[model samples]
Target: MNRSEFLQRYHHLRQIDYEADYPLRKTGRAAGVLIPLIDHPDGLTVLLTERAHHLRHHPGQISFPGGGAEPQDNTLADTALREAEEEVGLLRSEVDVIGALPEYRTISGYAMTPVIGFVKPGPVLTIDRNEVADAFEVPLAFLMDRRNHFAHFIERKQQRYPVYFMPWQNRLIWGATAAILRNLSSHLCDD
Candidate 1:
């Protein structure tokens, strides 16, 4: 959707479902991710990054720029902005923090807070090779469309858990990132 329509439709302050339909740990370390929505002429696009293949966890996965909370961070929002700047060279000043979704606890022991931000897609991002290998943007319209989402099941310890996947062109946006987008869709999509 366009900027005006988005702003008018999405009431960030309203109550929303904090957690997606997934088994979550009771406790996990606080983490934050910025769901950067860049304002394009036609519609908004979401900024995503492919994790470095060498990373210890979730290698080569598509994700938002964020990480575990540091002591220096004043809030989860701060953590999101800090990680975004560090991972993608997105300046803090460029992002306008709109709102946040409730925390989604991952199986990997993270209480990931999804911070939604509005940005203009002009800055040349410097991808940190250590954390991210590539950065790309997917149109928000494509992502928010429920038709584009697929359900995949993973068997762990004889239990089947549903994972969401949104394949966009050559990239497969799945796992937590896709789940997060699904969560966002619940908020942004009209009933």
Candidate 2:
């Protein structure tokens, strides 16, 4: 989808109500932004980040640009934008937030709020080495394609957990981030 088309379609997504059914860890809240970058030759791409391995939570995982909500954040949107700027150096003004998806409950215990946004792909992102190890963009078409989505099982603790995994180029996207992407892809494909 083009920028205009994506904006038109996702703007309505903002109106959908999201339920926060899961409890968060330590009373901390986090907000993340799913920034869709549509390149000139390629159409649409989604910007993703690889977190630094030293982080306390979900270290080295493929994720959107975000983190725990701060007191200065007036709203979830603000928290997402602020974290995006801090993690990937993408300015808040450059993003056009389309909507928010359902609040997902992480196994590590976080009630994550995902804010969807469309951004022009020209920004030169300066990654924070302490938080983000690298940053890259994946074709939205590749992710939205059902053929690329797969299910995997792993035993953690004593129970087996099923995870939806998506691989883009060299990046292995799994865990909560992958689940969110799968949900978004399912919604778009169903429409």
Candidate 3:
């Protein structure tokens, strides 16, 4: 979909009341922003970050620009905006938040809120060397395509759980990130 179409559809997504329970031993909350950048002709692209391998959680995984909520954040939206700025150097003024999807609970024990935002093309991104290792964008059309999504199973300890996995280029998008993307894809593609 194009920029205007994506934004219009996203703005109309039915708000799902969902919550995720992370497996982290400690209780905490995290907020992430799904920044969708739409470039003309090429179509819409979703910005993703590869976290530094040295990080404690989900190291090197493809994710949105976000992190644990801070005390200074007055609301979840603020938390998402702040984390995005810290990780990707995107300014708050540049993003036009459309709405929020349902909350996702990670097996690692984080109740994450995925904030959806529309960004204009061409913002110089400066990645935080310590937090984000690399920044990239994936075609929104590719992600929204149901044919690209596959059901994968993984064994953690002795229990087996089915999860969604999407592979684009050499990057593997799976786990919680893929789950949220799957949810978004379903909403956008619903006729």
TM-score of each: 0.92, 0.83, 0.86
lDDT of 2 by residue, 1-191 (tens): 66665556554543343222334446545655555464545588889999999989778889988877778999778988999899888888888886887778776666677888878768779899999999988888788787998887767666666687898877899878877777676546544
When 2 and 3 are scored with TM-score, the better candidate is 3
> In model 3, what lDDT does residue 19 have?
20
Error of 2 at 182 (Å): 1.0
Clashing pairs in 3: 20-105, 22-106, 22-109, 23-107, 23-108, 23-109, 24-108, 24-109
Clashes of each: 0, 0, 8
Q: lDDT per residue, candidate 3, 33-143, as tens digits?
A: 555464656687888889899999778988888877788998777888898888889889988887887777777667788888878788778889899999988998899
Which stretches of candidate 1 lie above 4 Å from their native place?
12-26, 157-159
Error of 3 at 122 (Å): 1.2
Question: For residues 1-191, what per-residue lDDT tens digits would candidate 1 score against the true structure?
Answer: 98888877677556666335445546788999999999999899999999999999999999999999999999999999999999999999999998888788887879899999999868679999999999999999999999999997888767787799999999999988999999888778777
Best by lDDT: 1
lDDT of prediction 1: 0.89
Q: Which candidate gets the maximum TM-score versus the true structure?
A: 1
